[model samples]
Target chain A: MSSLLNIIVVGLLLGGIYGLVSMGLNLIFGVIRIVNFAQGELVMLGMYGAYVCYLFIGLDPYLSIFIVVPALFLFGVIMQRFILQPLQNEPMMQIFATFGLLLLLQNVVLAVTRGQGYTAPSKLSEFVISVGPLNISVVRLVALVAVTAAALFLSWFVKNTMAGKAIRAVTQDRRAARLMGINVELAFMLTFGAGAALAGLAGTLLAPIYTMSPQIGGNFIMAAFAVVVLGGLGSVWGAYIGGFIIGLIEAFAGYYLDPALKTAIWFLVFIGVLIVKPGGLFGIAGAEEVGLREQN
Target chain B: MSKTDTMSGVTSTRDEGGAVPPGITTFNTELLRIAGIAVALLAVTWVYSGDPFILNIMAQTFLFAAVSLSWNIIGGFGGQFSLGHGVFFAIGAYTTANLYINWQISPWLALIPAAILAALVAVAVSWPTFRLRGPFFSIATIALNEVAFVLANYFGSITGGPRGLTIPFKAGLENMIFTSRFHSVLLMLGFLVVCLIVCAWVFRSRLGYYLQALHLDEDAARATGIRVLQVKLVGMAISAALTGIGGALFAMYLRFIDPPTLLSLPDIGVKFALIALIGGVGTLYGPLAGALLIVPLESQLRAGLSASVPGANLIVLGAILILFALFMKKGIVGLVMQLWDRFGRKSQ
Candidate 1:
């Protein structure tokens, strides 16, 4: 029973981080309809940002979130304006561009880091909180709390903000959105920025748990994709729920099976979900055809 | 053009084998041209026979070309845009390497079973993914590749796991290992020839027509009674089998296999796609063109740059890929063809 409880607690905490990372992918895919292959790279970059702040400036990683998130947001906007905008019409080429970004950033980071791993330093990094036979790491609890707050804040932002309404309008139909006098390109840039910021936040949140490396994004990128796919295409809430589901599955599988096979287990579920319902568990029906419908 | 007319046009074009598309010339001339290129390739190999480095590059060029050409079937001709072809490549390598290691079987015999299994796996993957279109399909293939990567590590006992598998070096005709670099390269060239032959054969067949049709538009292909699913499955099978064969050859050459080296993401998977993309997609010899340029450049970069600058080559490659995708969407073959059209032979 204790082990089960431990798994659930661990899974939920891990799920928070997963949700935080995957939300950006969801937002980008929802509005821009481009899978930011470099989102994982962005997360890696954010972790490095935190690493730098701690090592060079002596700022705690959690505290550095203020700087990293906005910095990443600006970087996202620049990427969208310069790189992604021209390739917007060519969906396939956008894949290549994002992949190019991924390669470029990952290699750049590798060169800078010299293929080494570093744990972002923080005083609270190892803090643990005990509650009646269940002891949870305080850092993980913080990650969970922060992400939940972010999700709620994002929901409210999308629901209330004029820019958020404009973004949603563009997602439904780009032509209509443009006709309605919304700055479609600006909306795309904003969405991309938001996605990047969310991914950056995920990086900082996960920094304590995972050792930082150039290859850190590689593991998350695929799992995040799986989460987005399993949760539903273009649904942030679905991604949040899907993240927990995968986290639980991974946790249980890691304990029950050989730890190495946990990713394999959830990916199987991802494949099954794709085969059974390509729309994802939380996605609207017929979302698969939307991408196809765009070109013609 | 009507769908039926397009189908028949592709069919008639195939039957003649002389109908030069936009990039090709007249039938007899094109055949002569191909023969000439083949002779030139052989001459280059023969001239540079003493240079072991050049010889090794040639061997790799042939092997990688074969793999990329196989990928072109599904990615270019069929428009699936798979980024996980390394799974099939790894499947082939593992099957051949394991058979040789565990049972002392010759790699020649092992290639057949490896390709067959890879084909079956391809069919399985295609069935589910064909339902999703565009980047979704590509994403699924990536996910599937990860699943295989993990499993390959998990079942490490049989697979030699992450520790990697090294084939014992022995020189013999049956073992397919040769003392002279020339013979090894020749073997790889022979495989390349087989891939080219199969590729050319399909280029003129019903399968080729259906594949091109599918590439243009899946729903339209289905409307035209092309049996979209069947064509995709068949295309994937052929591509996977050929890729598997290439993997077997690559394993024999390297004499070493590891989970990371075979199909671990960008290393092998993206390498094949990049080759095809750089050369030209949906063209018969594009993979060869890509492999010819990229494989040598990769080696030369390592020889020249990596000691001083670690990530320069990849940064250049990424930049080039982005530039290619944006400006030169059709790739190097298309550029060459456009140049040929402008200056090479105006009166053809």
Candidate 2:
């Protein structure tokens, strides 16, 4: 019973992080329709960016988030304009182009950093709160709160903001949006930047708990992918819910099964979900209908 | 006036109508392709025989090429970009290793069953994962590879775990051992030849058309009676089988199999996918071209940096992948084909 409770608690907390990371991926895939294979890499970069600031300037990683988020946003914008824009029309081209970008960025980080691993020095890592039999880490609780806040903010922004509407419009139908005088290209670029920035923020938040390394993103990317798929394609709520589900699964798996096989176990669940429900748990039903119908 | 003449600079005017250009016939195209293959075979064989070091490199290159060509069948030809090709490669290597060690089976005989098992696994993976498209498919593959690696590690007791298994060296045809590097080179060359021939046949057959159509537009292909699911399954099976064969050969060549070397992401599946991508995926000869350039370059780079720099190969390889992706999307073969076409036009 205690182990079950522990698993649920850790799972929910970790789910927030997964949700946080996957939200960006889902956002980008929803609006831009490009799977940023480098999404996790970008997260790794953000964590590294925070780590650099911490190492060089002695700034707290959580505080450095203020600086890292905007910088990553601009980096995302630059990548979108230069690398992703040209391949927008062809899905295969996008796959290869982003994959190329993944290879480039991952190697660059590995080369520059010499593949060093580091830990973030932050208050969150130290803070904790106890309630009866449940001893909760304050930092994780804070993360959960922050993630929920971010998800809510994103939902509100997409629902109310003019830019958000335009982004949504473009995602639904690029030709129709263009015909209606929407600058579809700008939306794509903006969405990509925003998505990347979101990933950066998640990385910053996560740095306190996790160690940073060039290969860190590889693990995160797979988990994020599973979360995104389980949540359903292009559904923000799905990402949030799916993230928690995976986190719980991982927490339990790590405790019961061998730690080495935790990832494999979760990935097996991911494959199962994909096989059972290709649309994902929260994905908008019939979203792919639009694209498939036009092709035929 | 003709599209072919305009593109190739061959004249189709009345002055030339009396005698058809020898180059324009279907027979000529086949002959040219055959001639190119023959020349490449001769050159590689010559290199294999002339220099012991070159023979070793040639053997490795052919092995890499064979893997890349196998990857291209599903990834490039069928348009399913799998980031986790290591699963099939690992399956092949491990199956052969277990069969040979535990069951006392010869590597030659082990390959057939290994490939069949790999194909079944590939099909099982496809049945579940093929429903995913775009990045989802790629990510699923990566996940699948991870699962395979973990499982390979989990069954450590049976698989020999991280310590790996060593095949006893018994030099004979039955043992699949070679006394000289030349023999290994010849063996690998045979594998390459078979893979290339299969690729070429697929490129010309009805399956090729179905694959191309699926790549272009899956829904449209399905609507046009392409049977996208059937074609994809077949492509995956073939890809896995070839990869399995490559793995079996790899085990035989190394005379040992460790989980890290055999099942690791870098050595088997990912390497093949990267090579295929770098060589002009989907093009018939692209994987061969990629293998020739990358394998030699990697070897040279490794030798050059062995003393001064430890991980220079990673940097160079990453740089080349980036450059290739950005500037040479079609790869070396694509560029060569373009240049050849231009020169052919000028001469005509």
Candidate 3:
């Protein structure tokens, strides 16, 4: 009973991390409609940003979140304006350009740091609280609270805020939104910036939870893709549910089956889901056909 | 075979309903110029540049040219944009490598079956994936490739797992393992020739027109009685099969087979697509240009940067790629064509 409880708690915490990592990706992709292949590299940049603050400025990793989020938002804005916006319609350009950014961000980081990695011990992770037979780390609890709050905040912002409404409006119908006096370009730029900020925020928290490596982004990005696809293409809450489910699967697989095959197991499930539910579980049905099928 | 006469007639026709242009003759001249460049490249190999390292790079370029040429069929012409081309490459390499290792079958014989298997796999995957359009299609393929990689990693008994497999040393044309650099380069050159011929033949056929039509608009093509799924399947099948053969050759060249080396998204998959993109997708000679430029540049950068910063070379390449993606949307061939068009208009 205790072991089962332990798996559930641990799995939930892991799920929160996955959810946080991918929620921004969903937002960027939903509105911007570019896959942002370099999304993982943005997370890597954020972790490095926080790590630098800790190493040089004496800021705690968690505390550096304030700096990381805004800086990354600006970086994302610049990227969108300069790189992504210029070639929006050409999918090849968008795909390869983001891919170029992925290569650039990762390699530039690797070159600058010369592959040196940072690991900061967190006080929160050190504290352990027992819930009946299960002992959970405080850091995991903190992460769960942070991401859940972020999700709720995002949901509310989407429904209530003017900027959020504009973003949603543009996504639904760009030309219609433009006629309604919304700055469609600004919305795209802002959506990308916000998405970057969210990814960066996730990285800052993750840095303390895991060791910082140049390739950490690459490893975790797969899980994020799996979660996003499993949950729904563009839905926020769907990503959360999907993340939790994947985390549970990973935890149970690690304990029950070969731990080495955990990633493979989830990926198999992902492929199966993609084949069976072409529109995803919560995805707007027949979304892929909307833009392409209209002209014909 | 039947397409030769029709291709000759249509070759002079310009784009989109074949509007005859003042620069029609200039376009034919451009095609000749491209042919001349290919001939020159092949001629250079005859000088027998004795530098072992240069020979290795030269041979490697041929492999890349073949892989990218094949990729262009599906990705460039068919507009599928698969990021999982390496999955097929790995399938090919592993099939041949495993057969050679376990059964002692000659790689030359194993190549055909490996290619056929890869084609079948591509067809199977593309059946459901054809429903997806744009980035969603790419994401699905990437996930599937990742699944294959992870499974390959876990299955130690079958795949040699994460430790990877190495081929035992054997020499001679029979084994497809050569003792001389000259022989390796010669084999690769032949492979490149075959790939070029195949690509040229494809562009001259009705299949090419169907692929082009499908890429521009799928529903419209379907309405026009083009089998949208069939053309894409054929394109992917040919692409994967050729890539598989190239993989086998690459493994034989290095005499090693590993997931990171063959299956890595960056090294094989992206590089395959990158070569096509860099040269100019949909252009016959674009992959050749890409391979020629990238193979040498990457090698030089690796040699230069490995001492100090590990990834500085890749950073430079990445920046260049981004610049190309932004500014030079069509690549070197596109730029050249634009210049030629300007000259033709001025002369007329």
Best by lDDT: 1
Q: Is 2 or 3 the stronger prediction by DockQ?
A: 3
Clashes by residue pair, model 3: none
Candidate 1: residue pairs that collide: none
Q: Any runs in candidate 1 off by more than 4 Å, and if so which?
A: B1-33, B345-348
lDDT of 1 by residue, B3-39 (tens): 1222232223333343345534333443444455455
What is the C-alpha lDDT profile of model 3 across B1-348, one tens digit per residue? 111221222232223212344223333444554455445555666564677877887898879988998998888878888888898888888888899999999999999988998999999988988778988788777776777788788877766888888988899788899888888988988888778767766665678778878889888899999989989999999989999999889888888877788778877888888888887887776777777778777877888876787887778778878999998888765765676476644664
What's model 3's TM-score?
0.93
Reference-based lDDT, residue B11, model 2? 19
What TM-score results for chain B when candidate 3 is compared with the true chain B?
Answer: 0.89
* CAPRI-style quality class for the chain A–B interface of candidate 1: medium
Interface RMSD of each: 1.3, 2.8, 1.6
- What is the C-alpha lDDT profile of model 2 across A1-296, one tens digit per residue? 87688778988998988888898998988777777878988998889888988989988988998999999999999989988787666565566666656666776777676767888879668777876677898767777887798888888888899998898888788888899999888888899999999989988888887888777877778788888888887887888898899998898888887788888888878888777777787777655334333310
State candidate 1's DockQ. 0.68
Top candidate (DockQ): 3
> Docking quality tier of candidate 3?
medium
| Each prediction's whole-model lDDT (CA) | 0.82, 0.78, 0.80
Q: Which pairs clash (backbone N, Cα, C closer than 3 Å) in model 2?
A: none
Residue A46, model 3: Cα distance from true site in angstroms: 1.3
lDDT of 2 by residue, B160-231 (tens): 777777888879888778888788887887888778777767776778779988988888899998888889
